[model samples]
Target: MSDPHYLREAEKYESPIPSREHILSFIQKRPKSKRQLFELLSIEDEQKKAFERRLRAMVRDKQLSCNKNGVYRPFSNRGLISGTVIANPKGFGFVSLDKGGKDLRLSSQQMKLVFHGDKVKVRLLNRKLDAEIVQVTQTVKTLVGRLNINQDECYVVVDDRRIKHEIDIVELIEGCADNQVVVVEVLNSPTLEKNASGRITSIIGNYLDEGVEVDSAIHRHEIPAIFGDKALEESAKLPNKVLTKDKKGRVDITHLELVTIDGEDSRDFDDAVYAIPSKNGWKLMVAIADVSHYVKEGSQLDAESLERGNSVYFPHRVVPMLPESISNGLCSLNPELERLCMVCEMEIDSLGSLLEYKFYSAVMLSHARLTYTEVNEMLENKKSKLRKKYKKIENNIDFLYGLYQTLRISRQKRGVMDFDRIESQILFDDQGKIENIVARKRNDAHRLIEECMLMANQAAAKYLQKENEDFLYRVHPKPTPEKVEITRQFLTAIDLRLDGGLEPESSDFAKLLKNASGREDENIIKTVVLRTMKQATYTPNNEGHFGLAFEDYAHFTSPIRRYPDLLVHRAIKRALSNKHRERSNKMVELGAHLSMTERRADDASRDVEQWLKCEYMRDKVGECFNGVISGVAGFGLFVELTEIFVEGLISVRDLKEDYFIYDDVHHQLKGQRGGRIYRLGDLIKVKVASVNLDDRKIEFVPVSK
Candidate 1:
């Protein structure tokens, strides 16, 4: 049956229903039969049904609703729905409704008035999940970046690229400049036509400056590097040394001849090792700075540490997790001063199998702060100055070196794969300019510390696993079939193939690396193989780490900087006190957040490194260097330089000989004009054609004969 069309023949009556509101009002007063409704609407019987259908649709759409009897009433559920905005870098966003059912797909046009992390109220037009942003509820904090100035007002461009709105500044702040990054408090949000207004609270600094590393670290982790006065004052109250009362009934290993080994300029010595040969195997003790002893839970310092999650480190500076009073003094395992520590005592056999392990809270004193260079020199030449100065601690250092060699062999036997990836350490001159990019080499001493830490972490993981406790687990899942196939193809091209089928174990990977060690394609194959594996992430579930081939794994040794390690310490303490069974939901939540923040820190560090590297090469444009094809894309191929660890792209258009097509199955580019093929790991010479600081990108042109 056809429904009544209210618009049709409406002009015939003098005082007909004036509008939809009037018609709705007329129908609300009394119950109207179909015949009466037709007369009221002034329409034919067929048209009456159409009018009824239209009324029903309006009610269902929340535009209108029918009363219990027969009359119509306007929907009462009106105003707005509040939600959080999750935006993508592509400008589009999704308003995850707080009232909660399904998310509304907010287009870039609708989101033009909003920014990420903003609370918004949107009037839903349809139930199809695709809704427009009718209005914004509340604006959250805006990310700080460079502010663009105009005649009367200025716009504050956000550091977060996902934000599309520019906030207007009333007047110039004290330290804000053209390219300098600053945090602007959003006073007003821009709509379709209006602009956002903001006031500068803090100036980060010139983004191009070396000091910006701290700014990037803080901003990236969403942590406040600058501590509040109250927090700093609270940190000042901490004691300079462990009190005698706290050391009662605890093992005082202060005179154990322990030595700290780290970089030359490291301030906080969190870990110090002492080792000696035993009849059973080796007696190794790893003593970590007990920050927990000083920074008690729920204290100001502890709260701030929880907020920061972890310490952020750049090349030149480290934003310590705790105040310098603790990290560098009281809590630091400095020599002469007795410090509290959570020590891990372990017994290991000659083949690197741990026989027994014990954890304890104790008082320890470091005998000396030994730098890697000093120890390496002492090992290389016994007659060196360092060997003469620290002659007493030479036995312990030698024992540690022997243990590290044995541990490395054990790790290799267990099929642990280590990719020898090259990393550049940027050296800065007196003017805060990059003097040179030095490729960092892995040395025996470095590996020694790493192996010791790895052993401690493994022991921690095993302890947690045996306890059947719920803790933050470091897990790395296996590779995907597609990635495995790709790796296979690349390996086959390099005249090497896995003995097993597509699904090879960690041992297979280790053997492959060992077979290709010192070969031309070693680095390239390592890079590709690494890409095939999944990223290591922290989860509550106990899936083992595939890369390390560990049945269990958790970070334990570096509590000063890593939150996971702190949690592990807490877990260990609870287990020791027999209170580990009482679990808190909040701790688990904190672990997840900490893990996410750690990843964010790593990404931010990488971004700044790329920027600095590009800035370092800004003056060296047109210089040529030998490189290898690291990656191939549709647009270009990425080349990593041999001398300097800089990576740049070789655009396809620059290969002017012929048109090239990316061969996906083979992982190469085939040229049609000259039958030339460029595959992964192909060594080539490239010239630095240009550098784009805006995007932190570099362009390279292939150097041809």
Candidate 2:
């Protein structure tokens, strides 16, 4: 027992204590404590940690188990892996592993025993990591969906398509009818032998009601919408206008002539900026609304804000993170009104290098609430009426523009990657229906504001890092090796090369974009490169941002809308006031939750927008339109209409007269016999073939000239 497999373990690890095989075999008949195992294995003080680690490895690999009392035994479910089931709408699923790796694939039959979002333990069914659900550790308690009644039977067709099962309606809500949306409480979860069942808890409304799509998505994503009673009461007692008492212990920057630049229909303005020429370079100040000052720690408002994570914006309405009294009233940096703000003041050199920076609480007066169009016109067109009207602050605007240009040069030199992607704006009619979808163009004013915010964010990150405080940073990790390789293959086929070898820097990506500047497939190249990048997330660990090429970065602006920004504000205040005090221990958990909620908001918004787009295109079946191949996959090509901005799929099966082979690396489908390639960024004419509102999909067919 003491020496079995000892030589093999020694070969695999240096200073090996005990082999996993020996540990598992020793505890097979009876559970043993760590002390007993240590004594039995004759482990020295130096080898004690190694022996404990071997036990943990055995537990992780499902060879042994450790209970709450610190006793270990042979694992009952030896080969099962714990994970969360992520089911697809096509009757397949994947188990997102708890320890993290490639997901285990689950086929239709294997997925029958569990639903989407179920915490489960699975056993590997094949060598390909295909798995079968052995047991469900947790099941979803309720589902939001449309109630369907067929003659004598009833079921709920879930709003989340990823949940492929229709819950049998064993109990129904009174007055609920066909095609009505409702929430169903799960009375029974599916098993290998029995189907899932639920009872209707609440009836929302008719499926065709105006704006029901947004409402359904809100419930489907479990977004916190209504404020709690306590939070509302607290918000009601707050002052609508800035009070003199609130101005205490704050610097008065009311004479700075700061301006708030935003979209025409924007609300809840959170940041204002002003700049002036300095001896060396320029002095820039970014004042963000002090949201944390009003929402105190452990207060009701803070709890509500944490639950929301961030504000969810829709085309017609917004689900604010804080109550209206805070987000839109007291904290909004409205023009002609004094407001409390946390100011980031930076001293820089002529080349836009930061020399020093400081943060302080201040009272600011926004002289003008400017729109991007107005500012752009003011700078470019001196003869415009708007330019002459806002002439009082013309000098301030000029200085800010100068600062932006300098910062932009520094950014380029630092190898910041810029993706030239087109974003669509939905134009609504008087009745709130989408009239048309058009591309949105970004002008210099947009980049001007972005640069200022980026500077402030980076400064805050550096300050906190230097002070050694615990907080969240906006982090973007480098692209994976697999993605980099795929991008390399695609770049090579186009006669382009990605430098920096396996671990390419952002400069390499910038160089590729610059080389592709005048080409027809420029946007497509940008798109491919963009897809190769990973999504930026929040983390307590400062890994830096790859996209912006910043050495330190945190989201310091938009505290009224984002929770992490609020957290940053609190951390900064704490660091400035008491350097010796420790930061909150919940930063890690908050980072993960805030990141997840941000994604949740984005997905919910996208879901509603896609549904509306489907409705808009429903009447245009058989109409011919020109589109660009925006995406390519094995099943089909996603084509975005040039004028309308709607996207539809051209199925591979519809390509008659030849068999098409998909090349994912090149993002193209090549016809075997005809030798024609349809790839990303290729222009083509198509006709709307069909529309599926339930699936939020539009189908297209190729058209000949």
Candidate 3:
């Protein structure tokens, strides 16, 4: 008696809701033809299949949009495409259209019609894969991470490893417990079946506390790390030093004895240097720390330093990109006192080339903050104390160690690769735990302050490309030929080749790391030509850098802690004063979303420092370590170890003396019954066996026979 075809299609449709306008006026017309929408509302073909089930349940609850050649349309005649969801770790998500091309995918059951940073309209259902979603609109929320709980329910999970969804946790905040992390907030969001309801909003700790690996790496890189009260009242109106009347007309360079160098328990000095011995030879200088002139450019301390696009550091703490009344007191360059910087001033020659450059705006004075083990004991010991503490910068740190041996011989005659990888550095202790890992030794004052910050970031990328400026740069490029034929079939099964061919040149991977220098398979073929290079981002264009070959590069020496080196210090103060400043198209869409959230905060701080170095070797589980076969794939092999540099895995069902398989052109794994192989620089031994830390993974095995 009721569904008389929605009462004869509500008596032939006309009440465009007229009880004195009860508002539902979405009228750019269009909607008629599911049989011409039940025969233009005239219903009755046996109540026209209940008036096509009340107009396909008002176009599946979005009140209207039947667009896949099924006509009907009307949600104010739809058409608005702003994308970015890409979900597939199956809670179904796919949007990626911020106006580029194609990319639409959708389907967590046709995206129960949209969630996950939603701002959709998507019409082309499939004009040969132009796929789309959110017919009208929904998810404008749901993304705050790290939860997992589990007692009276919990899940929230998303530290955006590309939105792989977990979501669920329905309201709870009493210091939420089980693996205690927290910070949820979502509230109803999934798509194929009820899930996305959250709450907890920050408990952030307990799972391995005490700076819980820096509050779980600033809550898995959502990175804000406290500082609002209008960014600590605009960092309490800045100023802590730099004065002599704000250094009367800039550039004093404090008698250019600039020093700094870093890391011996670094505390924010943000670059400094100085060189000398010129006349067809060396001048150098550098400087830095002006942090976009006390963090300006849309303040609340530049919106908490653009929501932390930099300064994370982790193992034991340092979230800071700004607060410490400006990154450790009015932008630290700390030492003698008056700071302010920005410099550069080059002019090298003894073949480190450059021979000219400028840039200015200064007022420096660091003169000794030294470290990298006291400039590698004053350049490999000349009876150290950095030569009786400075003695007027010991002939400018020995002409900056002969301009870092003429910029490591014009960076190995312009090819560069030298990847003797093994970095390490964990240590910790006084209650923060991890007491030792080691490796970090790069001496000669860390290659003379890394060749004077790569000659002041290739002279600030050729001084902002001779003023045709637009910023960011840094690049890297050159790897793919399928990762150089998977690094030439894993260095031709260790016989090792890399002698310029098969696209080699980075000085033929620096002459195959100087012929595998002092081998032990030299960290297994320099971690296999560093997993065949290319990962140095930040772009505005100039590609160059293939591991520092540099036609131009940038990161103008740190700008306190990198937001693309404070947009290369406001594009080197608008190209040293031609000053147009304009910028904002939402600052080039937030400089490509802060360079993809600083490469997802450096891959979630190297995945929580490889899950806290596999929970600091989970009490050395069954020992055995030597390791190597660093990855082969058909579901397992990986390994790595060699004195606690952890890495785990193995699992080709524990390679129990047979059935191995996965060769894919010899990156290894062979065995199908004792043809025994394993590959990627073999060396095996394994042992660790288990440490998931909720799938940050680790597990090894094969030591038996």
Local accuracy of candidate 1 as per-residue lDDT tens digits, 547-571: 9888888888887887677778877
Q: In what order do the candidates fall by lDDT, top score first?
A: 2, 1, 3
TM-score per prediction, in order, is 0.82, 0.88, 0.32
Candidate 3 global lDDT: 0.72
Sorted on TM-score, best first, the list reads 2, 1, 3
For 1-705, candidate 3 gives per-residue lDDT tens digits of 123234444576653211101112322355454665444444455655554565555655556555546665555444656675555544666677777865767766666555555666665432333444545455644354566665566676665444655777767776576666666766666655666676777686766776555565565556677777887877787667765676766877677788888887778888888888778888888888888877888877776777787777766566777777667767788888878888888888888879788987888888788777877777777887658877777777878888899888888888787775787778878887788877776777787888889888888888887786777777778887778887887677677677666566577787777878887768767877887887777767777887777888888888677777888888788877888554335545665767777776776678777777878888887777787776778988887877767777878987777888888667888887668787776788878877866556778898864
Clashes of each: 11, 0, 4
Q: Which 10 consecutive positions of candidate 2 have the poorest summed lDDT? A: 123-132
Give the local distance difference test score of model 1. Answer: 0.78
Per-residue accuracy of model 2 over 397-440 as CA lDDT, tens digit each: 99999999999888889898888577788888998888889888
TM-score winner among the candidates? Answer: 2
Evaluate all candidate structures by whole-model CA lDDT and list the values in order: 0.78, 0.88, 0.72
Model 2 accuracy (lDDT, Cα): 0.88
